[model samples]
Target: MSAMLRKWVLWLLGLYFVGGSGAALAALPIEHWTQPDGARVYLVRNDTLPMLDVRIEVDGGSRRDPAALAGLAAATAMMLGRGVGPHGGQPALDENALVEAWADLGAQWAATATLDRLSITLRTLTRPDLLERAVALAARQLAAPAFDAAVWARERDRLIAAWREAQTQPDTLARRRYAQAVYRGHPYGVEATPDTWSAIDPAAMRAFYRRHARACDARITLVGAIGREQAEVIATRLLAGWAAHGCEPLPAVPEVAPLERSQDVRLPFPGAAQAHILVGRPGIARRDPDYLPLLLANHIFGGGGFTSRLMREIREQRGLTYGVFSHFLAGRHAGAFTVALQTKPDQADLAVELVRESLRRFTVEGPTDEEIAAAKASLINGFALRLDSNRKVLDQVAAVAWSDLPLDELDTWTARLAAIDRETLLRAWRRVIDPERLVTVVVGGQP
Candidate 1:
């Protein structure tokens, strides 16, 4: 080959590699559509991996269950993967079979409860045959749940036993009481009691399904090894048949107004070695205008790991607790903002004092310029690591759809962090995270 031709070829190859790497670095661009049945669909295609992960979330989660039937929504979600139609298998047996099939095909399926939604998730190799079968089973689970009577009894008994065991754990007991005290009369406060589980008869499950499990309220997200066209078809097949009915509106969770003093709830656990502490109040929702700014601010306050104020004050400086951290919940509706720590029972009072002081300082002065810059850099630099897998990317897409964030939100996140100045951080901190209303719960000691 001529020298000139060789040089041109090398330059072209270099450019191709660099450009291709850039395109891959840009995760998957989000695409959106409304299904013919009116459900929202969000799609992101990442063909780098030979797998697909899908998540379907329906709104009105536990909130749709009647106030009298507190655990109904969760119970109904549990019933789904147990069996659909004539399959009529127990939850564990059905789940075992499903897992076995997924293993046979190198795939997976599962379901879970979140504060505002119930999610059914599937992951599978992108081969046509395995993908087809996996999605078909997912559709059956969604649209044709059997909620058999015998299965309900066993699940109810299991859940009751779990609840009973949880009550014996000081941390669990404190959280239950804390949630009830903080979010009374709202679905947020409900726990899975034997009574609540008993309220979940097959009829109740059917009623909750009819009310809350609608394609109209569903949001479907697909990521990995698929284009927009393929994602749309898969989503349609999986979700289109859900009974098209709206659910009831969520019961109002009243704002946590300031109490004269922070309420201290104490529960004893005999033979306990440590005390578990939780402190904070009703935080802003995910869609709050201050969401990004507050998230950035929180990093400096406690969410930034070793660099945070809580760690410096509580763990590193005084050594009151092994670990201490703070975070806002950012749910579909307002959720709790919390600072949590576990320390020796004898040191509980000292740990609580330190956490309170750290919070007071953060709210008062906000973050310094150096702290702010480091937090932003930490968040931006670490952000790419979050989308490292197809399943993780699907989670981000589902969160965006559920929280009504913009499709281009992830792409713009780093730039947004860079744009946040010190003043912006203080403005968000002052508005959303109030110091006076923070509820304090400590379990295992008198303190």
Candidate 2:
């Protein structure tokens, strides 16, 4: 009954929040500081709701995984929730007990790893009682994940089964090949095989967690009704265990190298109704100087949906594919600038050529004044809506925090987008992408 009531209350809060995000976003004032314990913190105080969202970013993404153990970072993050050790006179909580505890408090916590970082997120009502317990429980999970042998065995098997199932899909197949060619000889190219999955043991996860998920590399972003003082206490408590090891230097990761020449991988999928096509090239990092211009350029090129040039030519006029779009990944290191779409197997060749040609023309001629204006209006208008609720606000805050962007990024987002002129946007786009050098993959249309 208590959990149900909590859900009902939170649901009501969400609905009430739906209408005010634009205003909240335009006026978002982010506060930034470093915790004495070495954890960097970013806070956005939104008092409209009695709820909080907390995200902890660690430098433990898949890119840190050893090639032989391709999924180590993700597995280590998953273990954080399997169980937690006893602390603060609290009982040890297994996965089942952990789930129940969060339910009782009507709060939520989860740990996940992506290509560049491992993130642990917690959300809870800000009522004094609920928030305190939620923090304590999350602190245990962050500091003392048990990495139990039994739990790891179960998780390893489940992961392997899922990966095997994904291998049977056409998109995954094309993506695998695309990643391999695009990220060749890089950590991102390494795929997890069943053998690689089975090789991971509880001990490995523990060691990886200790080395990468340390105080020195931790970043915390909080969005809620909390003030600077309370936010400090919460941040400190979260890193209590992490501070024990002290700050130390971590090894460096190499950058993603651009393709020297064009590479295309075409595979035949017999009897498949459609061809899955992926075209990509190494693109910019989050902190790239041309980030804003390229971002807007991408929108004019393909990311604007129906209004985009790629969509205008390929889908609307040519009747090639029902949908087509493109975007840059923009991670810690260079990620792929990719275009993806599916069409009838017979139309795949024409579709791929059109995409390549469209990119070539856009690179040389660039977006027209009319297209630039429309893209800017769309991007600028939609910026505020991106921060409509606490969750949405938190996501943007976390990105800025993780990318080490200016604290006022949210405040200046639309302004910068609005300031970008046409020549700058074109130069930024043409400077980064060489349509001739794209690594294209086509799967299907077997002879």
Candidate 3:
């Protein structure tokens, strides 16, 4: 094999043997710095392989979409890599040209939009020349997006069609209605309906990009075979000319008030054999003190696969459905805790009641000592998988940067899990979860 290929193989083996251990993985050092233009940078130096992963996250995501333009943030993110204006009086680069430029250097790039941030990630070999070129290309994309009208028209139509197609699916309908029920007048509840899409023209998209994608709001996370000094230089160069102009700070997410009473809504789906049910309510933010405890508690409650109470009681014993699972999607602001299930339409009502009972039991009685120990063991042991590679570590680092979490959060994860006892778990569950106020949405049948 080539030398690069052999190096990669050995690196993979080392990660499997060394990073596979929870303690060793957590001990990896992370460095932090800031650029002159006010962009924050986080770095982890891993010289195991000759590759680098860079992510630029801005505080602009779907939640920032204007009231009239529901999909504006997503559209802006997608357009960033489509085309760029002429740099230094040179010719412009279109989407295909941009792809070819990266391909020639064995690099890859992508853009993603979430509720709280828009992230652009680039991965390239760490050879000085290749790294320099990749950084220049990314800078162009971020600083001088063309927002071509032709490209916007085509992509907009495609997005609208995808939304229309999703509307026909039972699960999608249930999720949309569930968001509406849980978030009611909040931005989190907004979805890209047909009318919302109609209001998003090219000009509006350009305006949204300018108003949200500012350097001041950016956070950079670099991982792989690079040092602290090189990372600082790279970050500064990549963001040199980018500035915050006409940019507005993201509005604070409103507090999610508890529901006064339980709400249930059912929608019809013609000829669907199975029912899609969603039970949930507003959940905690990522920064909440009870986040970790609730996470561990939920694992025993429903997120532990077959080992969880919901799976064992609702599926293994009673055979009400093929699968049942629950999750808490903690965002920058308040998020959602949801239990989702699919079952034959005939068993819909019983399945809903069973799920409700299971939640109530979990909330009131809390997890047993045995259940808690098993959950702690599973979570603590499995965390090594989350840091097995530079890519995974970069993702965690980016999340910490964007969410303003403690830099040592990953290092202390196992210790925190170990500290949760029966009382702690019960207190967190009682404080954050209220089974009586959950909103339920059933699609494809009446429950």
For candidate 2, lDDT tens digit of each residue in 1-447?
Answer: 455345434533333232222422334568899887778999888777899999999888999888888899989888898898787677788999988989999999999999999999999999999999999888888878889999999999999999989977788899999998998878867788888888899888988888888877889999998999999999999889886665678788899987999998889887678999999899999999999999999998999999999998998998988999999998988999999999998888899999999988999999899998888778776765676778998999999999999877766666567778898898898789998899999998443
Q: Write down the TM-score of every candidate.
A: 0.88, 0.93, 0.93
**Alpha-carbon shift of residue 315 in model 2 (angstroms):** 1.1
Instruction: Rank the models by lDDT, top first.
Output: 2, 3, 1
**1-447 in candidate 3: lDDT tens per residue?**
765345544543333333222433324577887776778999988787899999988878888888888878888888887888787566799988988988898998888788888888999999999989988888777778888988888888898899889877899989989998998867778887778877887788777777766667889999988898899888887776566453466667677666778899988898888999999888899999999999999999999999999999989999988889999988877788999999888888888899899988888888889999889888876776787788998988888888889988876677677777899889988887888988999999853
Off by over 4 Å in 3: 1-26, 244-248
Each candidate: RMSD to true structure? 5.9, 5.2, 3.5
lDDT of 3 at 318: 92
Please give, for residues 307-406, the per-residue lDDT of candidate 1 as tens digits.
Answer: 9988888888888888888888877666778888899988888887777777777889888898987787677667766665677778888999998888
**How many clashes in each structure?**
0, 0, 0
Model 1, 420: alpha-carbon shift in Å? 0.8
| Clashing pairs for predicted structure model 1, backbone only | none
The weakest ten consecutive residues by lDDT in model 3 span: 17-26
Residue pairs in clash, model 2: none
CA lDDT of every candidate: 0.75, 0.86, 0.83
